[model samples]
Target: MSHPDTLIAEDLLLLLMDDEKGRLSASSQAQPLLGGALLVQLALDGAVEVEETNSRWRPAKVEARQVAGTDPDPLLAGAWETVAQKPRSAQDLVSRLGKGVREQLQDRLVAKGMLERRQTRVLGLFPSTVWPAADRQHEQQVRQRLQDCLVAGAAPDARTAALVALLAAVDQAHKVVDRGALSTGEVKRRAKAISEGAWAAKAVRDAVAASQAAITAAVMASTAATVSAGS
Candidate 1:
């Protein structure tokens, strides 16, 4: 049996995708963001543990270790085991957690008939692959839930609260809904209220914060490296 919360990757895929076109939104930061979400989901499942709790969240120094007794589902179990090779900080684990992570997730969604993997040779010279949604049912449901929590002022459940925290961490909540009707101040206020609520466990919330910060830092570093190389 799969819990709705266990579908974090699928939720993320839906969030990234454009329903009308069945294409992922253009974002250079997708890899790191997905990586952050994966690690947070693993933590939420108790498959991973963070070393720090009393201090403010710090991505560069927080160490994540595997829990000894929990048996996660097969998909997450693999990630838990891989990370268990050694305890690592959120920063160290971002790209590591992301490596080939998207492909693994796409394969899972395809197996469930949520998406179809397609390949094309662009202009007969460049190879490209796309994972387009096969059905919008699941994604639409998720979006409705998001609207409820983020816009309609409904209290969030655990999974929905966690999803908001992730979206706020990356500052991408606006992309999921039409925020134009709401003030930016209102959006931030709503997010903060939910984040501080019971639906968010202290540890899980910290993990999300640390992971998103690490992902952001990693993206900046990668971008700087690219510019330096080109220069």
Candidate 2:
């Protein structure tokens, strides 16, 4: 059976308090309560109220200074009084109190068990479609399956063919070296031979010269582009 839609009274209270203070400044538990967008909305709508804790003292207006040294509970009462007068948005609250103090207050609220969280299907802003909801267990299973597949193979099906082509190219390069089979002394002799027969080594000489010309041209082009862009 699906759970019924419920709003935590503490969360609504905190959001209302944050609205009044222009930021959150409660215990750690209150942080999560302030995070809920729905709770914020309810506080703005004036659907929630802060219950008076002490029966003996029923003052019309509770000053901030009065609850200065007391615990967060009493401060919450004062906050409710202030929020009840004027409803404000979360953004307005943050703007008034500053981000740092607002976040600290949220943390304090969350640390206490007074705040509660519930799941709700909120509408998507951009896509205009309901997001598929999955339970915690289903999400864990999906992650585990994806991890298992990755560990079994280095490359996925689509990339397997490309990997084979790369391996073949490496094998061909190795074959070329094997066919040349020149000893250390032979390699030195070949170098000397090339120097002696410079005209006969025209093919190798032209390749080296072409590479140097391309590099120089590329550097000149890049410099010209940089200068033009700057200007």
Instruction: Give the number of the best model, judged by TM-score.
Output: 1
Off by over 4 Å in 2: 1-79, 87-91, 97-103, 106-231
TM-score of 1: 0.82
Q: What C-alpha root-mean-square deviation, in Å, does candidate 2 show against the real structure?
A: 32.0
Candidate 2 lDDT for residue 167: 17
Candidate 1, residues 40-89, lDDT tens digits: the string is: 77777665666764655543344445465544566666666667787778
Clashes of 1: 0
In order of appearance, the predictions have TM-scores of 0.82, 0.18
Global lDDT of model 1: 0.71
Cα RMSD, each candidate: 3.2, 32.0
* Error at 217, model 2, angstroms: 51
